[model samples]
Target: MSAANRSGADNQPGVLVTGASGFVGRYLLRRLQTEPVTVSTLQRPRHDLLQPASLTELCQGVDTVYHLAAYAHVNQAQIKTLYATNVDGTINLLSAAVAAGVRRLVYVSSILADPAFDQPRTAYGEAKQRAESLLQAAHQAGDIEVVIVRPVNVYGVGMKGNLMTLLRLLRKGVMPPLPRFTQPFSLIGVEDLCQALVLAAQCSVGDNAPIYALTDGEHYDIKSLEQAMRTALGRSQPAWATPKAVFYLGALTLEIAGRLLPINNSPGLRSYHALARNYAVDDTASQRDLGYNPRSTFYCTLPAIISAMDAGSAGADTSDTDNTQ
Candidate 1:
């Protein structure tokens, strides 16, 4: 990534972004350009997983620093790593920002900090909450303008999370057996989330007075969301509503086996637990304060994604068509 410099008279601030390679980071980086702000990214070195010193130097003279980097794997074994990256790393970054006289520290937290879940029981949620507390403490002590933004169940193109796995299953015509969750779950497109972040970075209304929870306008239950996906794909598939007890048992078994075996941890399981108990948020504050207007809902966007996937599959099928008859 090339650095694009701006004159001091431009009025836009120099912004530093951590987790520049992550799903949300990519969108935020692209969206920041439209605001005509000077953007710089921080990436960990190939061998060095932790780079607090490097982050410090990067924040020097920057007006706002957006901390998005974290060891996001949500499992028991990954607990230490998550704390190191999400908690310790945040502390390091905040210390550096304060030293460098950075104006604002916009933290991209998760909805897991909502207290809606028993965060103590979940490793990932607990880590996020811890990080939030650290930032809030820093804010209270007058270290920096720490603005926390909590987003729920973000999904879009190039998404590498649970939603992508579900989409992949749909592509393969396998309707995933889901839990019978009747909660009004919220979501925001990656694009809209980026917009909110930029607005948060530039906002001077609160002086860290409020912590915002962000979401798209529409909320859907698991059953309805699955049906929407099926309708989008124009396919009919049977989906089983696995009992919650059975589902948790399977997740527990997998969690145990994932340690002994070489299986990758599934964020889907954690998300399922969160949804099974309802994880909705009130984003009205973000909308009013940060000018955060969510884009199209799952019902609107899922169809487009499915239609594009279908078109791609159809094109691939006809790629070998012969005209030499």
Candidate 2:
């Protein structure tokens, strides 16, 4: 067996990291290495959830599974692919882990599962909600020991999606064309999320308190974020607030345009959701249960992320694959 496949090591009390090549997964893999635990990653082809082969070989002796794989992008055009990967794929993982006698499973979900939001719903949210429901049912049925963590926008270096777009806008001494609004955004750093995952897997929390919302414990104010980005870039750009209607109209127009064309990379009109809803997650449960104390506030983390981006830009060419889901 390859060294990476050693993660689901015969109930060796280590972690099996799915989506290890993605942004948060990369950070999680690195963070797990610092701890006194064996780490294994699920490889592609035969182990892929969509693949026909069973997960027997890959999950043979794994004790715990950190499931981070899914169609993370909110604007993916192929609706069928989204459900296939997120829903069916989750079943595949859960069933295989059960067959392998895994002790615990950590399913990473997104806060966008909030159904009350008025924004045009995306398939990504539907997919995650389905996955959560399946896992919850399995846990209740005594089929799997499952823990669910719903995180807000996760930020980290070398990450992709809207976060990167905002960073690029700031790097050029410009703020994102965001409207003036008061909806609070909940965000978490990749490092802190990894910590939360491990804690959720190993903590002595009861089954009733399994679902926890992950955040940095600070309310995200877009206007404040604008100022922080400017400060980080060392630019004295005058901060002017755009009217909410402008943002609304622009988003509506894009939403219409996206339907008419192939809006692949950025989620055109879906960007409005970032400006429209209250994404502030009550992290009291996470703090009380998992001891997930994030010391990095938006202001502090922004500067550090900006500095790291600057250094990376100087050393080598880099790209961020953005996902706001």
Candidate 3:
């Protein structure tokens, strides 16, 4: 075990945030700025995970690292790239952090990392699971204190990915009225996730690495969610519901098209399952250990998200949005 992993720094800890330009990362940075810690951010081209050489010095003089940089799409074609970045890149960062005598690393993992959710997980989920295992091994070896936070679907202002795509479609009125899906899912606001990350970093280090699953502690089904969003956006509720078969057919078409054509962000079986499946998580440990009490719900934060979408604060690019979150 490294002494650095056990002892406190004499001065305020230096914190480094990877993926500082990302949706959640941006929110985390803003939250960190309000704290007393010295904050450092990584620029992508200059400090990339795949380029292990670039990561060598990233953890130098940093007491804690917030690792949020991840390839967050579910395209199977990019499986190799996903593993390289999520799994191998994480190994690179672990090496750097250990060598730099960093004390702790707070990793932002996703709920999809749990293999129990799917019989055969998406490539992105597998990659995150692999990364989490590696981080756990490092922690076991006493290389660093590891705190892993597995957040369910995260939504907030400047949010992108599957949820954002849905919001865009809804705003355009091109999306048909969705069928009521009774399967409930969990979600965390970006700000709440940021708070959870900070709590993970600040909480006492234990003999074993701790993994915290986070959500806003609210129940949300697709029908109620759609109603809330529609009401908030001033969009009319559809007079009739679109049949489930219609959506299934659309997903099947997209799946076949994805297999035949070069497409990104296609709504295939993975996205379909993500929306339709029940993926609720228990965050009792987060509450007990880190005092994690989430304040924002999807209902409360819908306005900010709608406002961001309308004002173009969120990007229109389909390259990245975490549908598999």
Full ranking by TM-score: 3, 2, 1
Tens-digit lDDT track of model 1 for 94-126 = 887898999888888777665664432555556
List ranges where model 1 is wrong by over 4 Å. Answer: 1-12, 46-49, 118-120, 176-180, 205-209, 237-249, 259-262, 267-272, 307-325
Ranking of all candidate structures by their lDDT, best first: 3, 2, 1
> lDDT by residue for model 2 over 1-325, one digit each (tens)?
4645663334347678888777787778888877666787877764787763546666666678888887654334667877898889889888888888888889887776655431466677767778889998888877778898888777766655666677688778555446776788777887888899889888874554278888888888776677667667777756576778877787688777767766654455556776666767788988998888886665666766777787874122121111364
Distance from true position, residue 156, model 1, in Å?
Answer: 1.2
- Leading candidate by lDDT: 3
**RMSD of every prediction:** 7.8, 3.1, 4.5
Please tell me which model should have the higher TM-score, number 2 or number 3. 3
Clashes of each: 0, 7, 1
lDDT computed for candidate 1: 0.67
lDDT of each: 0.67, 0.72, 0.78
TM-score per model over all chains? 0.83, 0.89, 0.91
Comparison by TM-score, 1 against 2, better one: 2
> What does candidate 3's lDDT look like per residue over 1-325, in tens digits?
1212212333667888887777787777789878877777766577777777887666777988999888766454776887888889889988988999999999988877888664346777778888899999889889899999888888887776667777778888887888767788888888888889999998986667888888898868877888887788889998798787887788789988987776765667665675687767788989899998899999888888888777877643322224244
Model 2 misplaced regions, further than 4 Å = 1-4, 7-11, 52-54, 74-76, 173-177, 205-209, 313-325
**How many clashes would you count in candidate 2?**
7
Task: Estimate the TM-score for candidate 3.
Answer: 0.91
